[model samples]
Target: MLHRHPLRHAALLIPIAILAAVSSAQKADSIHYDEHTRIFRMDAADVTYAFGVNNVEELEPVYWGRAVAANDPLPAPHTMPEASSNDSAPTVTPKEYAGWGGGLYPEPALKVTFPDGNRDLVLHYVSHKINGDELIITVKDIERAVFVDLHYSIDPATGIIGRWAVIENKTSTPIMIEAAAAATWNLPRDTDYSLRYLTGRWAGEWQLQKQAILPGETVLQSKRGSTSHQNNPWFAIERGEHPDEESGDVWFGALAWSGSWRISVEQDQLQQIRVTGGFNPFDFGYKLAPGKQLETPKFFGGYSHEGIGEASRILHRFELTKVLPQGPMPKPRPVIYNSWEATEFHVDEPGQSALAEKAASIGVERFIMDDGWFGQRKDDHAGLGDWYVNKEKFPNGLKPLIDKVHSLNMDFGLWVEPEMVNPDSDLYRKHPDWVLNFPGRPRTEGRNQLVLNLARKDVRDYVYNFLDDLLSHNQIAFLKWDYNRNWSEPGWPAVAPDDQKEVYVEYTRNLYGILAELRAKHPGVEIESCASGGGRVDLGILRYTDEVWPSDNTDAFDRLRIQDGFTYAYTPEVMMAWVTDSPGWTNNRTTSVAYRFLSSMQGSLGVGANLNKWGPEDFATAKQLIEAYKGIRETVQHGSLYRLVSPRDGSETSVTESVSSDKKQAALFTFLHSSTMNYPYPRVFLRGLDPKTTYAVTSIYGRLSKDTPTSASGSYWMSHGVDVELKGDFQTAAFRFDAK
Candidate 1:
């Protein structure tokens, strides 16, 4: 049953459309079967992702990348080193999408503990069909009526294959699914592999870590019940040595799950390797009753033979054209001015009005009133779950601030943490049972807040009603949706004893449902996903949001690397980077205003500094910088990104270039962290430029240290490169190029 209430002012639901199937499966872009060998070949753009059923009726991978002419390439005769002589026959080899009952030591891709106490499940091919752009293959357990259907789909343009599974209990008995994954992707075993994944802490998220994929199961996961900041649910494998940002044959995959998830990369003793991803089993289990089914999240992967750069471009193109809201083309992100740093929790109508006026005087396109506008929320501990305006702060309601902001030619936005409640809030006081808790158990609290059980019908209804009413009553154009804490002691008491574990997954599902409903009601409003900051940012959350707060630490220097890690898996278009006060309260490093603006301009830019404290010079400089950013915003937001010099390489200078979609314009940013005693800077070779074209380059705002050539041939820029010189610490520069 769909959980939806009659929306007071709902519009025609603009259905989220899925990619249509290819004209014909037998055509060049899809599944083609070899009748003699029973081999299935799935062709993507420049790659071929194929798999076949072996003699034992288990799925085995044939090839995964750059199309080759070989047909039915089977494994050569080999003996297993991890098994005894009796069990060493090559006939018992581990299979792709391997299940239990096979002589498998590495984590099985699918593990379901049945009610009959038999954990072994040997799957045999049952049927195959192609419906539109997707190919569905059904497999059944040998002795049971359980059916597992595998879905394989590809977007022809990017060659990104989306894979997932559905496990159905066709029997009359209940099945306990402890460990079920979407799919396992197998890569060739002939080369040494290096694994790359993201990891970091609270205010510091998306720190990329790369190491050799040894002969063991290496897991990159998030068990915090949300896509945790500590580990991201994405992985990439490169051959032999660590590949630079621009070059290497890279295979990568990411899970489209907002809740607890895991991705395991395993290289067996015999050098065979596979990567499987899905829900994390920590504090998780689902009971599928008779005739019921369990569907897993989509695990999307792509191959980039050109290296990590092409990999990023592929993911970026797919996300831009398909996944993100306002599909195919993204709405241009506004230049935002947030009130959090200026007036953290001490919100008043007059103060915000003044800020709005100042914000408009400069060039802020959006004015966001962050936390403290809602009921009794003077601090973090109280007044959550109360959606009404705090009468004390905004005596009349948000209209006064909203009208003032709107009159200034800027859109108004607000911050909300709808899924949380404080003990002191009236909503929680009236409905304490609406939260996640086990009977008679101590409820664990983080940030003086408790997680509202959205998995419950009542709780979800309350959240949806408040959010819908807020949008209905206000002229809010955007919402900064924040999840401040992770789930601890997650339990749903109203649920049946054996089904409480479903809360881990159901909460995220309901959250998405509410977002969809809210969007359906108010099509004009956009959302930004924030967690204690960056904790819940992922492909899954990105689906519903227009932007994401990459981290709480907006100090431009630390952000260099943090943003690097984030862009490695996500596109910069959705990365909401901000220019904040410095010696940033978060990092205690002082930098010039120009340095801050240039760093933040690499993506969707925002300003979080206390503008009221700024002098006339600051305002003037800010206005100039904002105007300059606007001039090239589209190119930077939609352009192809090239990380010319990495901040992670322990270099004093970090450079990046973004060539526009039409190749007519490009924006380049350079940061000199610090300078040595009169040492000349390195010449930076630019990428993604046409060698035959001549370009007109100029600096924006003219705030940098040196002058670059007014015009240069693209061949000269690509070959001889440009030299950027700076003298002081935290100094930055930005230059724009026009193809002429």
Candidate 2:
């Protein structure tokens, strides 16, 4: 639900009077319907979306683009002209929600098969209701008892609309749903749009890919039983090839799903672009029983005429205020320190206490003890499903370590990978059938562990009970929940063969339910979702998680690109960026301490470096840098991000600026890969600031040009810009601006 704001009430007070001339005035940001014209117009922020019933009684898209005044004339609904006998009305017309029948050629919103072998299904508008910010439109099959309810809700703060559909089977026989989509969005005919999406592998995820939209279809999907790192469930379409960071019309969206999902961007025969996304149909089959219903995941979409950067800022605000758990007034993300880099699986009570002291000395707010603390988990080969503490490592259990961390003024967090089970663990030995596998088939293993079948009731209960008990016994304040592998040999022999395909949906549902229950039971504890890294980060998982590990590769240099592409769809509030050791583990590229810390401080800061190997200078530098970060963490986590200089295009420098919501505080970060021919950094301009307000600037790190002013008006900063004085390999700089 959207948080309460003045615009929310303004959206409710839509003028009902019909104007006869063009001189009439009406309030913006409203949703209204015209009975005579059979049109439904929704004005969200600066954009407008409308749809209505056509002459043939089918729902068709009317317009979706820049906002228009209420008195503006809109054409009455009419079916599109048919091209020929080969191109029927259903094929040419852009439908709001189309079924798989009546010679339809595009992607159908809903497809089903009857028990009597009849496949023809057509949907016609039945009824609609407007309640608060939501609009529900119901349609039914022409000659059957099947029904579909279309849901639309708009966020006043961001102009983003959430769309989904619920299908009901009211017939006496079961209906097999062959494929289902949340909603289909259509663009105007013959628009030159270029598609931009993210694609990458395990250690190298979130690489932005751009291509021109062709006549056929471009399918971006994940069939790995989870939101894979191969392709994220997000997309942005630019109106032309010349669109840049600051100017152009762009349309963007993201799906709120964690399971196997698919999004198809297709240009139809009439050259109309449409986006249809929902659960992947690769191995999808849902048998809806009589009187049962199925609801699809929500797909959110928005429009921005300012550019792709503004589109991202809009999504970022929507997520921080409406999508997250503690939105609108969320607590700041704590500066955390994880022990995995320090000792890995060799954690003990004294060693942990010593590390806690070092961490507390540097102002770490949360201490997370990563893997190898429980079961027989001395290595990746064993102790996954077993959730018990290691008796030999901690003779007095985790209480002493937890108590020690608590005494040092920090909350304690533990790492657990509950979805996986090693064959050498006691849990797997006792319940050999718990893992997902075909009967008598060889169970595939990743990281030497098999995925537990959370689709089964017994397995779900066991996993939940153990976690609940662990939290109930300890004073744990956070959990770094990790899932290390993808699904392989996914089978549930306990269920019937026809119903086995339900694992994809049921497993995700159970996982969400468990997280919901845990939050309800322990309201004070926070959770971070990590599937290896960036594997399961999506809107569905973000609803329960307080933060996310974006990637396993913490190399500061590589992360400049990784984190740059990440902010395109997600806010930095939930992105956990850690400062690891120099000579990075992934690329062996060493960066200075200031560079690494500043790179991580761009997002939620964390320290995963081995403190035991640090010299006094390292400790001193960390303490000072972290203090500077704390002064601006609020603005960094809940501010409008401006990508001044992108790290893409093989540029030698990268720059970003974050301005607070009130425009009073701003943080500027600059990085240089290497100096060449005595060249200086680019002139960086600040955005999202009040032009009339005067601001004072101070250096957080590095130095500015000798002639730079100490204070200036916001307009001066935007026009004249700032300059950095640096001449070295792997250099960094940061500055803070406070409104005077």
Candidate 3:
């Protein structure tokens, strides 16, 4: 429905000149074209777009004409293009790509080529209009080494922009790139603005302060850490959508280093514009021994006028696309109960069956058989390499145990730490080369285990097949894929010393490939990623799993902090925080049952305690909590979540609440950190409630001396408040409401 503005006379020459210059340049090696495919390959690299057609032939010329004929008034030319006559360095031109009317969808593609006469790099851009308002930009012939591709996309409907970057290591050597990519926006010079970065422990280094700029515009910046071959760093920027704002300008910049090849991006021209300086792609003189490649961790960034909160929502929507099916897949709720804390390392057929029995009794839907289910895996220090199920633990094999759980009307799950092998195991003894180690150096071990060298094709193939075989043998509804440790003594016998860092990034890529393959083969099975808890919880891993174990420390009190920190980057659905018994195994904090259940309800509600020991009262309370959780599952899972009170203030109490999408109903949970001897009372304010709606409040557990149900409209509850008194070591209460 959208139409481009008619070109004026002055812009006619622009397209002619640009096309002539492009024709004079060397012809690209490959050309691909298709209407349905937004991605095109030219020089061994893939270009992804938010929207576009597949055909390059049909797209290039049209987009070229538009770019050359773009009639948007240009800001004064800042600097003259550096001359090519200088023998000391290559000349460069700074170009500004503009997005106007909020629908200038930008699609970027990449290709690498070695120019005939020069080793220096020159990138070429081609644009396409495959769909309404969807623009594609393809850059060909960029010299490849270890470079990060930073690109941004804007959603036409929402006026929200999403940023994404990919690191392609064309060379075989590994490089340690520790840097952050930032997006800086230029505001109107006279505008006074308040800059704020979302606060949370996981919100990497961020700063906000006011400063004067030239008579042009103010600058807003958001920066976050880089991706090694091991990790990916990403950040997002939001420009609170106000009534007066006209256009939002965003520039993607990165600071990186490859040995001495350091580059940094800085705000320039007093906020009118910014630039990335200090680029030295050739400083290291590094080459990936033929047949090997390493890439910097990719970064995602964008600019939006929808405030930080809505910007987060848009970011999640983009991230969800990478993991969710293009078509509809079963929206299976991952309501799972893990046996690690309940059974620990002492798992057996009878124990698993008993646990499953207890789990089903309390409305548990998925029973995950955690560690100690495989090959003499009696303790954490041994039996890791051996992947076979221990017959002693399961007399008739795991099939019987899994069948038993399913017979009780619950899906069965299994855990595997595939990338690690314990030294005292059969596989390690048979193929010592499976473990990554230096030829003559001592291989360091953690938890009596060593990481598999995924860099080698043989190792990757072995691990991939092992997992495929395991999944094929069992009807696993889900897999608790745990990476229990971090990379240590980082070395690979198969890689040269100079390229050691490449192992980290390559290992992750191999992991992604393996996961991609597994997902394709067994589309029904769901995977839960756990890296000793939140260590590996990032957008990259979220691309592979349905959920993540927020932390191994699930004690209700600890999870208050854990879940609070997790929500900054991830949603509540993805945070698999649970409630378990206390004196807890780790902290020994004997929290009240209600308190534990309330904390667990904030995430995927699951139980990780010895349910067999629960008394009648405990059983009744657990049943009620489970039913209540199921009733509000959708609202809690998909609604907007806000943290009202934090437990980190050393206060004796904390509270959290979730409101329904329609704002018709709200759930409030309050926790008491310690028992109060006299006049113990806690008053809490409810959030996200509809003032017009009236509601009934009641205690989910048995009545306390001072506790009683009360009815109040949302306005009354918000103004007058609700209060509950507790006389126990730990306490919790829940309230529900409905539209009047």
Query: Candidate 1, which ten residues in sequence have the lowest lDDT sum?
Result: 3-12
Off by over 4 Å in 3: 1-135, 140-151, 155-160, 165-298, 302-332, 495-501, 674-685, 689-729
Output the lDDT of residue 693, model 1. 84
Global CA lDDT computed for model 2:
0.88
Q: What tens digits encode model 3's per-residue C-alpha lDDT throughout 1-740?
A: 42232222342323231222122122232223232222222211111122121111111112200111122222221122334344111112122222111121111122222223223223323343223322234332233443433344434323333333343445544333332222222222322333322222221211122232223322222111112212223223222234211223221222222111122222222322222222122212223343443343333333434244444444444444433332122252556677877778899999888888878887889998889988988899888868888888887888998889999889899999988999889889898887767677888886788888776788889888988988899888888887766555556666565555455446667887888899899998888877665545555566667887766777787777666555544567666767677788767778777778888888778777777678888877777788888877766665656555666547677766767668866776677777756756566667667787777765554333344346778887777666665556567766666665
Give candidate 3's TM-score: 0.70
lDDT ranking from best candidate downward: 2, 1, 3
TM-scores for every candidate against the unseen true structure: 0.93, 0.96, 0.70
Model 2: per-residue Cα lDDT over 1-740, one tens digit each: 51111121222244322322232232433666666556777777888888876666678787787777777766555667789999987788888888899888988888989999988778887889888678899988888999999999988878898999999999999898888889899887765899999998888888999999988899999999999999999999999769998899888999999999999999987789999999898888888899999889899999999999999999999989998999877788999999999999998889889999999998899999999889888889998888988999999899999999999999999998878899998998999998889998899999898999999999999989999999999999999999989998888899887778888889999999999999999999899999888998888898988999999989998999999999998999999999999887798898988899999999999999999988888888899999999999999999999999999889899999999999999999999988998777778888888899999999999999999999999998999998888778889999999999
Judging by lDDT, tell me the better candidate of 2 and 3.
2
lDDT of 1 by residue, 660-737 (tens): 887778888988887789776667788888878899888883333245567888887789777776667788778888
- How many clashing pairs does model 2 include? 0
TM-score of 1: 0.93
Instruction: Report residue 40 deviation for candidate 2 (angstroms).
Output: 1.6
